[model samples]
Target chain A: MEITPEKLRWIYTTMYRIRRFEEVLLEQTALGKSMGVAHTSDGEEAGPTGICAHLTDDDWIASTHRGHGHCIAKGVDTAGMMAEIFGKHTGLCKGKGGSMHIADFTKGMLGANGIVGAGIPLGVGAALSAKLKGDGSVGVSFFGDGATGEGTIHESMNLASVWKLPAIFVCENNHYAESTPVEYAVSVADIADRAASYSMPGVVVDGMDVFAVYDAAGEAIARARAGEGPTFLELKTYRYHGHFHADDPHTYRLPEEEELWKARDPLPNFERRVTEQDLMDDVEMERIRNEIDQEIQDAVKFAEESPLPPLEELYTDVYVNYSNPPQGLR
Target chain B: MTLDLRPDPLGPGFDVPGSEIRYREAFNRTLGDELRRDPDVFVMGEDVAGGAGREHLGIIDSWGGAFAATKGLIQEFGAERVRDTPISEAGFVGAAIGAALTGTRPVVDLMYFDFITVAWDQLLSNAAKNRYMFGGQGKIPITLFARSGVAAGYSAQHSQNFYSMVAHIPGLKCVAPSDAYTCRGLLAAAIRDDDPVIVCNHKKLINMSSFVPDESYTIELGKGRYLRRGSDVTLVGMSYTTEVCRLAAERLAEQGINAEVVDMLSLSPIDEDIVLESVTKTNRIVIVDEDTPRCNMASDIAALVADKAFDSLDAPVKRVTGPHTPVPYSKPLEDAFIPSPEDVVATTVALLGA
Candidate 1:
């Protein structure tokens, strides 16, 4: 479980990249350049950065509405994603699916679902496909603490365990489900504990620490690849922003809790660990930060300059046969 | 194509031409043939094997599914290819979509079409939307099998026809086979096609059989069949209602009125040219559907005729449909709720009079 210098650099860059990407989205929303509402992964970067670091393009991951970080970590082009958010023709879904439904099948990143807990069963399905194909590839599901309340998660977990499918369920417990506090919504003390009912391994980790999540996710993924069945990992983390761009977190969040979480911000925590151990110096960290910032700026520019999708595009991607009437509007 | 005016041979044990095969048997044979033909094809549903994980006291497949639609598939394909699942529709249905997205072409049984409501999100949102939502990078080649319409006494909950609800969705293809011959071909086409298709087999017609080929062959989707042809008036029917239309046509012949019966096989991408041509030739039309009247195929077909065949129509389109309420348990009430051959005859007569 020893962390390599290369892994540290990747985790640092990924976490910062997620932070910067969300910041640009926030700016776009403020300027009214974005299409619909968006949920950002400002402080929850470590979870995706750690878990996806162990995955290859052969593996698959299903994500939630707040899924930009997962898309980036899974290798979905940021330029295409930003263009989608801006409702341009060059978007991943050709502007048909905005932020909430962004997807890139080539990268094995299933579409981000608008419905909570919907991705769990889809991930289990991909795992079933991989198992049937006799490949060692696995499928991962990234969902929020709120999704733990959905029946789909429980059904998917039991099915995966019974079939011994290679599926990993990662619960990002960000302490909130939209405006509702997780404490009032979830009946379980630890969401991972539910895994035992399905006869699967369950682990809890510090979502703010990239190293901890990396080690835990790696073990679970390895177990899945070896045909040991599914694993549930509950990562405790927090979202620095409101539930969505237009939402007011202060209405439901207490000032003291927000302050306590900010002190343990995932980006700053990873930067401190890397710098303190001399795995990476301040100069190197600054360079990575500047590079990500410039990248985000370029993506915004690309999205802004891109043309609006043509009206005929409305009927284009609905099916492979753009002319077949069964799946077409015409 | 000449209309086969021969009386339905399905009776007193569900007989048919050549070798009499029941609707369920045709379905079973098709699954076995497809599994043997393709390596990536599989069948999964509740009670599909009935003995998936545990031994069934020397019996391999006990239930064979709710309607015996998947009987004997477990023995042929084994447990991995023919899997029995818990009563979790959303999970398995979504999983089927996932499997189709990756490599497998899965045929999933939703058990009862009524139960699709539980897994509606998966079918409507994911399965139907994936191909288009992913910018043509993904395709869901999954065939969903479900029994719609009333069986003798299954009552309101288990006996509703909701294929119209699925037909309204953009990326979904819906088919309701009237008999055994159409069922095998349509089901095979649904499995081999690169899009998600829902095959709604009427529960009442499961025992009835027609002349179906013993081998695998696919009938083209989105094509309507002219069950019987005449020039006096066009009678439109779908699913089990097609039988009623044929019987009504015979009764009309006794009255010296010719009725051309059209079976609306593929509901969504309806064969508009056939329908328009039939109406244009006959100059009179009557639509018979077992589903509740509003927002159903009857209304959709009516709109199509009104829009495209308005000049050819000598009379306004007439429709005989089921009542808006759920299928009743009482025999008399249920009989009244469903449209009968007599209703079709009366509707066609009224259209001619108008």
Candidate 2:
């Protein structure tokens, strides 16, 4: 697949946006401006940005707890997401769902579930609706390699294949399921190979190579839209940050292993390839980086100024109407 | 003007007349009517279409579901509206929630109420709590039809009634309609309700029949009905226990004691007004339930009466409930395990005497 100037620029900008967003969040955490746990998708940016580049806003996607990158790639408002993390009223879930549960239905981003592997069935449900409604829209579920062990993902895959629903199950194999390594937990050598048991196609891609992910996602998404059922794509990736901001790094992962992953950084590799091919110049790339930095700074300002949800909101949204309140309420 | 306390015989409110039609047929008729009236109402479940890929039988809509409650739905509505899923409980049930969130109102059959455990996360975590958890941003207008109550020989796994588990969860409305009329109206109400609801239909009540209105109607959630009025004591029953109450009321009448039978139709947001009023007038109460005694409806109602209307009570609240054991398979043991009409009469008489 030939990389056009516009497509290359989009990939570069999306990746940069995710990286800068996380960097701002990290800074905010250090300043004590944010509360609760947060997981940064710093090293896994290429998988979400590259794959989402091949999708339309009509296509539905479900994300994991480490989901800021996926939400940005899928076009969730950066201001709303930031305000949400700040516990402001202007948040994506109106201040109810924090970082882990942020959702924007209008953008077809279902949610980032706190429970591991819970979003798999939701994505399948979205695909089932599209199929039953006779729409060509596809659904995608993005989870870590850890989610492959969940029963819901297996059930969802079987159901999606049996019904011939339009769905793509993408596993961001970041080599770790929290503190545990994938090699110690997963029985299968490759998560994608498990897809064959459900009679669906599976592929593995170099998550560091944005072009590789885009090419694979394009084919999988096209097949889903063409009524070919579901596909499972495993993106081999890594996360630079610890599982969460609060986690102690000395307990599990080795410092040397982390350095190895950091050395093969996705951004530098992409820049080298694009520059070598004469796809873009360093000046244009630097300009894109500055633009993304400004966007992230503006988002932080918006979050800082946004109001917190009123105290009255605590009792509200418990039901459509309180006429027949649940037993506990009374 | 005063909330129309006088119950309309044809409306969804309590004090309405009972229908003689079977529970299965009542559900089928209600689904059929709702589909006909509203273009967006659809039905999906296992074997709901009877046979999908079988060529030799050449029979369409044959299975009609495990109990045949959805028998003629596909025939009338066609495949698009009446869908049969591949025994994937969590997937399809979650899909039903998603569809309801989007635009469609789907009636999902879990085959057996026990199977709902497999889909509990979606039902409880997602469907039941979505409205409140999302701060009321969305509504889950979905109805789940499930069969419950012991079927004599189905053994422990299939026979146990698990309505209490759902009733324990907030934001989920649970209904176990005793007969055909209540089933039809309640099922329709569930479909129309903006919140998630679970209708636990008794397997034994499926073939039982009663009189039903020719027009569509809905029985509001949280309302209880006075199935039989009396002055001696109030015998509260729900689902299959309604039959036990009726028989026990007859036996109590023979001994010159008038017993008022109140069907606690809606379990979650129970009709406290009706129950308190009945208990105040009678000054005696006997709560009958088919589920085990511990933490079941019997104890729940007992606590409600004790907390709200303790002074009005003439005696300690009595409970006639299933034994504290799993539903037995043997006929005699199962018969002994479940609360009997005799136990209802004896308990009511004893409470009144005390």
Candidate 3:
């Protein structure tokens, strides 16, 4: 697949937006504005940015705990997401779902799940809907290396394959699940290799390189849309921050490994590669970076200004038609 | 002495009367009718389709589901609509939620209520919370069909009435049908509702027959129905226990005690007005349940009467429930575990004497 200049710029801009969004989120949490925990997708940007570039709003994507990048890449409104993190009334989930559960159904971006590997089966269901509707839309599930060990992932993949549903299983292998490293938790060396058991194609991509993911995901998505069943694409990525805002990675992983991974940071690497390839110049890149930084700032300001949801809002959405309050709750 | 509220179900049909069908047949007919009526509805679960990709082995839809509730659905709807999945509860249930959120209305079979533990998160955390957590942006019109109740000698693992667990959650609705009639109507209502509803079919009651309409109809979810009415006392029975309560009421009638039987069909958003109204008249209530003694629907009903209808009560409310032990496998032990009709009659007589 040939990369057009417009697509290249979009790719660069989305990656930058994801990075700045997380940075602004960290700053807000540090300043005591937002109260809940957040899992940052710092070093892992290209995976979501590249894969989601191939999708439209008619298609769907299910995300994980570290899912802001996926939401941004799939076109979830940043201001609404920031407001959700703030637990405000104007948030994406109307202040009910916080950072870990940010979602935008309008963009076909399913909510960020708190449970590991939970999104896989949801994506399979979306794929089933797409197939039954004959909409030519494919579903993508973005999980982590840690989730490959979850039985739901295996079950989802097998179901998708057996049914020949239009689905893509994207494994964002960030090397560690909380404090436990994938080297210890996962039985297989390559998470993609496990896909062979389900009779689906397994491919590994350089997660830090946007073009590599863009090419691999394009093929996988096309195959899915063509009714060729599911593909397991393992994107070898990393997280620069701790599991959550409060976790300490130094207690588990070596500092040297973090340093090594940081040297291959996706944002800077993509900038150099694009500029060297004459896809875009340093001037345009700088302008894009500044624009995204401003967007992140605007989101933070919007979240800060939004009001918290009132106490009465709690009982409203629990059921679509909750007329008779069960005696216990009433 | 059963109630036939509607027209005799089968006057012109060729073969058997509508009242001759089992609860499972009512369930299967409902599924077939829905599949024919709406294009967006489908059925899925382990062994739902029975035999998939094994036509040469001559094993086509062998199990038909754990209790035969989905038997012969695949032949009517085809494999596309009636899907058989692997033994993965969380995966398929989560998928069902996703499908419901999108466009299709999926009826997922949990096989047995006991296995809900494996897929608890998918139903509780996702299916129950999807609409609320997402600010009501989507509708999870999903029906989770499972079998419950004590008897059949299925042992502790497979025989427990755990509908109360899901009923306790805020976003879910629980419906337990007493006979084939309620099962058909309530199951249809649950499928059509734009919220997640669990239809807990009593394994012992699935074979029981009732005068059911050949055409599909829905019972309003939270409205309790009275099987029999009298002046002496009110017997509140739930799901399978309703049968026992009715039997007990019959024996009470022989003893000159005019006992009323009220089937607490919808357990969650319980028909409090009906319960309170009955309590006001009779001034004595006995709640019967198949679940364990503590923290179950029996306790909930008892508390509701105590808090709201205390002044009307002539004596302390009585509760007849299964012992606080796992259902045993042996027939005698299982019989002892479940609340018997004699137990309900004994409790009501004792309450009147007190």
Candidate 4:
């Protein structure tokens, strides 16, 4: 794949933005700003940034608990996302969804589901919708390696393949689902290999390398766009932190494993590749970093200034209209 | 709240009765009408269009769904609009929810009410909660229908009247229509409603016939109607239980006990006003529910009466409900498990005398 100057800049910017958002959101959480648990997507930035770079708002992507990276890559408003985690009135979901369920349908970010494998079939549904309308749009689902064991993943893949729907199932092999290691829970050696059972093309990509993901995902996405069928990509990745903000990765992960995965961090690797190839200079990289730093600060400030949603929000949106014993507090 | 039902839901259209149709035909016709009414509306479920994608072999809609509720639909709508899916309940239901979320009105035939457990997580977590949790930006205009209740020796796994579980959830709406009339009308209302609505199709009522209008109209959701009127005592029921209530009212009438029959249609945004009003007027009520006794619809209504209409009660609110047990397979055992009209009449008579 040819790397244009603009495309290279977008990958760096999007990936770095995700890293900073996860980092700053945690700092804010520690300061008693956020409402609930937040799962960081610090190390798995390449998977979403590389693939979503190929997408427009016309395409849809369903996300999992570790979904901040997918949200940023899909171009969901960062400030609105920050307020959502803060549970403020100006939040993305009007202060209701919080971290694990940030969504913007206009941007084709379906939602960051709280359930393990609940979002997979949703992506297939989107693809089915696109196929019916002849819209030429595709749906992508991002989930952890653990979600492969879930029946929804298998069922979704089978449906997508059977219908020949334009869908992609990207599994982020982050090695752990909560405390359980992937190897112990998963049935196959490679999660992508399971796609063979569904008669879809399965590819293994180095998730730590954004360029490799870009190339593999480009081919897979092209096949889907051509209406060949769905594809499964197992991006072997890792999360720097634990399953959730309050969890300690050190409890389950070894020091060597953590350090080993962190050594190939996508951000620094991208910086090296770009500068070595003379595509971008140190000054340009520094400028991007500084802007992202300021942006994260502005997000925190916006969340702090935003108010909580009014009390009456408790009664709204359950149904379009349910008049019996009319809604509201007694 | 009062039983302020807006006129008659059957409406002045009842002045000219269209035709007598079975419950299954009403459901099938309503589905066809709704699909034609909206271009975005589509149906998907196991064998909903049956043997679709086998047109090369010329075996389209060979099944037309388990109960034939969707009979002869694929021929009119084509396989594209009336789709058949693999036997993955959770997968397709979630997909239906997702399609509903993005854009498009999806009607899912859940096959049987007992199988609701397989797709419960999706309905509970995604379809039901999406609008509220996502800050009310979207609407899940997904309609799900299924045959409910134990009948014809379906045993425990295949037979269930578990609308009570759905009623417990805040976001999902549930409706149980007693006769062919409400079956067609309430179904149209559910398909049009901008929410996740489950239309409970009772097994026994599927073959029962009643007068249905040819016109398309939506009955007010969350509203109940009176099938019989009297001043002595109120007999309340839903779905097939409403038919049971009608029968019990006739039996009570023979004994000179004027029994008013209240058919509680929609269960979620239940006509609390109607339930309260009926009990208030009669000062005595017997709630008949085919679901098990514990924490079921009967208990829920009984609680509502106990809390709100405590002073108006001539006697304690009586609930003639199925025993708390799995619907057995044995003919006699299954018969005993179901709450009969005799039970309702006896409960109402005992309460009236008290």
lDDT of 1 by residue, B1-354 (tens): 112222222332123234668898888888888899899999999999887767646867889888888888887789999999889999999888888888889999888889999999998889888767667778888999998997687788888889689888888888888888788878887888888889999988899976765546776788888888799999999999998899999999999999989887888666787788899999999999998989988998899899989999898898889988988998899899989989988878877777
Clashing pairs in 4: none
Name the 10 consecutive residues with the lowest summed lDDT in model 2 chain B.
Answer: B1-10
TM-score of each: 0.96, 0.94, 0.96, 0.98
Candidate 3 Cα deviation (angstroms), residue B344: 0.7
lDDT per residue (tens digit) for residues A86-164 in model 1 = 9999999888888988889889998898889888888898999999999899989899999998889999998999999
* Model 4 quality (TM-score): 0.98
* Most lDDT-accurate candidate: 4
Ranking by DockQ: 4, 3, 1, 2
Residue-level lDDT for A12 in candidate 1 = 87
Per-residue accuracy of model 2 over A1-330 as CA lDDT, tens digit each:
766799899999988889889888988977876757788898888999888998887788878899999999998888888888888888887777778878887788877878787778778877877876777888898999998888878888888888888989999999989989999999988889999999999999898788899999989998999998899999999888788876765588888988888777889989999999899889999999998888888888999999989977776665554355444446
In candidate 1 the C-alpha lDDT for residue B93 amounts to 93
Q: Compose the digit string of candidate 3's lDDT tens values, residues A41-120.
A: 98899999999999999998888989999999999989999999989999999989888888888999888998888877
Interface C-alpha RMSD after superposing true interface residues, each candidate, one decimal: 1.7, 2.1, 1.1, 1.0
Q: Supply the TM-score for candidate 1.
A: 0.96
Clashes of each: 0, 11, 2, 0
TM-scores, chain B, all models: 0.94, 0.93, 0.94, 0.97
Global lDDT of model 1: 0.87
lDDT of 2 by residue, B1-354 (tens): 011222433344433444456778888888898889887788888988877555357778888888888887776788768888877787788777766765578888898888998888878777776655454555778889888888758778787778788888877788889888788888888888877888989888888887765667887788888888788899999999988998999998999999988887788667888888999999889999999989998898899999889999889999898888888899988888888899998887777777
Name the regions of candidate 4 deviating beyond 4 angstroms. Answer: A325-330, B1-11
